[model samples]
Target chain A: MATTAGERESSLWVILLTFAVAMLFSVVSLPEFIPWQLGYLRPQWVELVLIYWIMALPHRVGIFSAWVLGLFVDVLTGSLLGQHGVAFIIVAYIASSLYQRLRMFAVWQQSLIIFVTIGISQLVNFWVENFVGLSQWDMRFLLSALVSAMLWPWVFLVLRHLRRLFNVS
Target chain B: MIGLTLLSIALMVVDHLSDLLDEVRSGLTVVVTPVYIVADYPNRAADLAQQMFTSRDGLQEQVISLEEQLLLMKVKTEKMSALTAENNRLRDLLGSAAKLQDNVLVAELVGVDPDPNKHEVVIDKGTQHDVFVGQPVLDAEGLMGQVIEVSPLTSRVLLISDQSHSVPVQVVRSNLRLIAQGTGVTRQLDLMHVQGTADIKQGDLLVSSGLGNRFPVGYPVGIVTQFKHNPSEPFAKATANPSAMLDRSRYVLLVFTEASLREPVIGAEG
Candidate 1:
């Protein structure tokens, strides 16, 4: 599965494009595009994208890049400046370290792992937000993690299709 | 990973403790505003298409209704000027200055904060239009919120319904002063520190008291929607629905009040 020099070069652009679209999806108010109630169940599109890239191409996208992108999300959402950054760095570290095993799992098993990773990320966000007195504790905060896990297979398939189409490493 | 974690914590601490990062955040907002505009494109396009496809007869009917409404408002305003002049004369007799008229700029909401836990919105007005942090915002119905961050072409408003936001308000009937805190619910605000025997009741009107000098006095804040009292508890809990349409308003007014203009500069130490 070794990638040639040309494939490696092209993958960078594809990665950036995918990440950009994911970021757009993460910040856009889906409620306006869809039904209002469904906004509460909107999946963590950026985290799903990050997880896919880290699993598919661990060497190219790692912890540091994830942290930077998380900062972008924080600024975009008007949350605490570093709230997403910390959670994302942890998720990226775990995903990259386990990338070899993660790629070999069945889609359902992979989705199970996504449930754990995104749950951890959401928990970290809840902790930081509550610590700063920005948000209250609620059972509903965990809803997004579950929703992200449910969407994992579709996101994985689409990202995989894009990677193969672009011959991305 | 450890370095990044520590750096992020440091940023959180700095952002929470001081206004130092506000400028940096505002500068970054310039870069992100394009994304918001693009994200908002679909709604704007839909609105434009609706307008274009509207029937001419429907437009004419709307114009006639608007004209009649304008004439009625003009007549009311004529009476209001006489009342205002008399009020000013009475205030002068009491050795007080005349009430300052506020300058206002209309801005449209361009985007909403996607985080359901937080309440904030981006307005189209910014520093280019003299918008600044701490400016009070209002919808046509009532007081809404204040500007927290300003970029070149846009600004972020911290809605009064945000969990961290609070405003000083007085009951219109009893003149009882209480602080209204956001419950992170778009439709309601919680009144803090009210006694079980307080005069608050359902249907009471709450208006800004101007105690902190941040919000102007006598503007409608909310109306008491629910009241709960427990004799054993030291304080009674009450909730009010905000007068402004926090969830649906498309346009807001940025009020340029004298107090905000005269606010003291934050020292470097802060």
Candidate 2:
């Protein structure tokens, strides 16, 4: 039984590591990595992970984690200080707020809502950057939102498998 | 918490007082570099493996041709160094560090800001590598913007073509200095505060004048694409395409120095 607990703990670490790696991958926007316009079609991998953890183990992923991740992103991306923090917090809040409703929705419906949430998050990112005086205002900004929406189903399935593996009852 | 906010505010004040923020940003950037490298490793390896497995004869031919081009460039660079030494000698007589060009660290762009209005990009190098804010960022061709923030291993560069960004530039052919501001269009720069009678024209090259002591002097900034002047209006409506390879850059150089700390006063127009 103690071994089983240890295994479970290790698995949890694995999950967190996977999430961090995924975030890093999503963050590194090499030109021509995606077939679309350069750096335009980045999927909101951070938002996907946020939604997954919120849906699977709502207790572990919370407002503070979301805020900190946002800060990391802000620091990494070099935007205004709190811009990603503001967006991530709002996205997590909305995801958690709609958690029960989201679980009941079909995969596509859930994905749509996720799309809108990530879209709004991107918009807020745009807003804060512009307000802090870094506005670009190009249509390519919509690319990430679209890509994130499309990837939602795959992310959902992956989270479901991880949940079962962990036996998150 | 409000306490955290107050603390951050205090840190901001202290940072301004003692320039401690650069140290903190540099430390954070160092820490993040490993994370970015670890994440990039697997994909990069897979790419290398794939390249080894399937490179073709045509590609090899192209590589040989590219090598020839590179050899030509090396010869040109040798000549450039001789001219640069002569130019430095002249500049020394004029009194100043010859406006040493910013020593730029070439960094792979990792990400773009997740918004349309915010034209920012994340580069792999950060403050740990000695990158500083106010340092100009550039793509292959021209000015992109400045280093706005830095993490331990990464830094963000604000592109000059973003709506909220602006830089001091001079018309190369006519020497008409003006502040070129971004309009969020990502395609053009709006030259601000120029009079209708200002000696400006289409196809003029804009270069950094190094007046603010922020960006190094003489980097190609943009080119005049269009001009609109109304007979009654005080200023001419002019736009220039930013010289930076804004839409196509995958790597950027962060220039981290100026010739002086004090702003250079405008010399009388020759």
Candidate 3:
């Protein structure tokens, strides 16, 4: 059966809204807040939003979109050109491919998986960076992934409303 | 599927063409700057309100004391100028050109990266004001970071406290050179590749060794806070607290050198 017109419209809205949120999230804060900063609690708002959209509407947010988003992030964050694009494409594919299994898990369980996905993404980022002859490792990578995972629930709730507003299923 | 494959291949090629893409990157920076400004308006208003509501007496006292300190520092600096001139003269005689970076344009700190793993700051300066990628940023006390992304009227800086940030620095005490990398936590920096027997200690000041040529020489970067020599390993792990107040800087300076714009990254003492 064909998807409902409302669902299709909502899907487009969700993807665009998510992209805006990711862009804003990426540029909004300098990592200077919070005292005694734990490395695990870093916010991966973009990845979180991307995962949500990819799972919610795989048809709209696909490999090409993820790659473009990652490219923008690369420019925004000043990483090597393809560094974020590669990581994002990998994470987007992983999250989307496993969406069926992931959707069935409890919220907490899903957060754990999200954490792992982002953690793996960071590792991939580190690996590619090193391969490009820019190798430097610090504990913050794991910490940021963990923290971003922890924040997934709240992010999901917020983005879900945006999805509703945009009429995305 | 073939179309997608072709698109991916095209993107991969464009991604590898870093040098050729600088113009496009710079152009994109110009295009999205307005978005950042609109998003940052609320935060700026809140900060302004907070500053306006601060206790009058507190603000007055701060200004008075700061002026006094500045006067004292000015007197001391005057005394050191002649000595500096003599040092420069000697260096000039030795055929070493004195490399001086221009003073930076002060930029407002609009936002911090929401992610703690990536220590970055968005500043209100961009290509519109001639700020370019790789411009050195400085907080009141010392080195902060470099501009990594330039939107038309805004730019993002990667702070020295980010894991991705690294710089070549020399221990003020021993002049031992090492690469200092960010630990992704505010105020913490780690020096890589120091043997256990190295003559570095806690409280040692690390200055930009000027060897990297990316950063101007003689700026304070950080102070060694922890030094551990593991008997099991040949290398010692050292951490420094960045002198730049990354957490509190409301205003920062972005130093741009027109001459160094296209210059290669200089490798300094390792």
Candidate 4:
């Protein structure tokens, strides 16, 4: 059901809050003792959170929103500008398109899609960075996709809980 | 989606190849500063916990050890002062530029770069504290990196171990000049293009030669940890361990050389 105007406005704030938290998590590094080894083990928090928001409220979040969030990530990570925007745009388009079928899939099945999509986005990033000769030439970047896929179940559940608790559409 | 991707590519090209987006990045940093502050809480909490949980006797022992170290350092400085004066006289006789004493500002590590591949860290000092891009950062040990981007309240330092970073170095023992390049590993730097007959050896100290004017002259940069001269290859290979604790030190010092200070103060934070 379409919500009241006030509720909708409140949901937008809730949505933005979730995005902010995701950005915070995305930039925070692990302890010094734990070596991430080229971020092969780090999960993509922004992409995961964006996926949740788009799947839950596709009408509100779109490719434009993802592009904007990607720019935010670029600044946060100190990468070349718009590095993440291209990947987010591509992933957001695919995600928004299949969000319907995604809602019906089991968590594990959805995670398979998560693996594929994150892998694709990572490739896009790899390509862009490679163009500037910034990325190391290795297949190991896919390890992050594996880690993101494994974390998808928990991320989906927690974000869903937050959306419901905030009474977001 | 295609149109947006094209637009993103245009932005990336501009950013990677030019300084056009530097202002944009710094302006957008206002949005990131608060997030970084919140993200840094865990590190702050861990440090706080260490202070809180340390027994009083433990702290006293640390203080005693520090005092002893300070006394030892003072003795060394007394000799160093005389040596520095003599060296300055020698340089003046040779009609060379005398070394300028550097001004250093203490900065706290606010955040580490989330990307593990890019060895960069964020420091609390920014334009607000006269920290500028290309300023050298040092840990208590030795050279760490240079500031590459400055926000209003924070700046980012690209560490010496970043894959894209390199510094001009000299062997203190042999006076051999070399280019120490980052090999994308923590605390490890490679001396590139070593001639087959170079005199590099393990345990030799590498100091900043300051040829490129990027880092301060005479700062400890690295130590030759491994060396090999291959007969077949055109060049030999040597590796060094950076003097700075590349992966550990949370407190870093930003150095203001005479060159960096010569620029006009564009705005506030003088």
Q: Which candidate achieves the best TM-score against the true structure?
A: 4
RMSD of each: 4.3, 6.1, 6.0, 2.7
Q: Which lDDT tens digits does candidate 2 get at residues B1-270? A: 344334434543454356556666566556556655665565477668878876598678889999999999889877877777788788989886754434556788656654444677767876567766677887778988887776666777888887767899999988889999987667789999888888888999999988877878888999999888898888889999988888578678766554434232322110
CAPRI verdict on model 1? medium
Error of 1 at B60 (Å): 2.3
Question: What digit string (tens of lDDT, one per residue) describes model 1 on residues B59-87?
Answer: 99999999999999889887877777787
> What is each model's TM-score for chain A?
0.90, 0.85, 0.84, 0.95
Sorted on DockQ, best first, the list reads 4, 1, 2, 3
Question: What does DockQ come to for candidate 3?
Answer: 0.26
Q: Which of candidates 1 and 2 is the stronger one according to lDDT?
A: 1
Cα lDDT tens digits, model 1, A29-144, are 55344644455676888999999999987878999989988887887888778899999998998899889999899988988898899889989999998898777777776788
Structure candidate 4, residue pairs in collision: none
Q: What lDDT is reached at residue A84 by model 3?
A: 76
lDDT of 3 at B22: 65
Tens digit of per-residue lDDT, candidate 2, span A96-130 = 87888888999899888987898898898776555
Number of the top-ranking candidate, with lDDT as the measure: 4
Q: Is the docking of candidate 2 incorrect, acceptable, medium or high quality?
A: acceptable
lDDT of 1 at B244: 94
Please, what are the lDDT tens digits per residue for candidate 4 over residues B147-195? 9999888999999999999999999999999999988898689999999
Instruction: Write down the lDDT of every candidate, Cα atoms only.
Output: 0.85, 0.72, 0.75, 0.88
**Docking outcome class, model 4:** medium
Q: Give the per-residue lDDT digits (tens) of candidate 3, residues B1-270.
A: 235445544554565555666667667656556556666766777778889998989899989999999999888777766667777688888987663435457889876664445677788877777777788888879999888777677788988887778988999999999899997667689899988999999999999886766887778899999999989987899999999998888899776553465432332111
Q: How accurate locally is residue B210 in candidate 1, as Cα lDDT from 0 to 100? A: 84
Q: Report the TM-score measured on chain A for model 4.
A: 0.95
- If the candidates were sorted by their lDDT against the true structure, best first, what order would they fall in? 4, 1, 3, 2
Model 3 TM-score is: 0.71
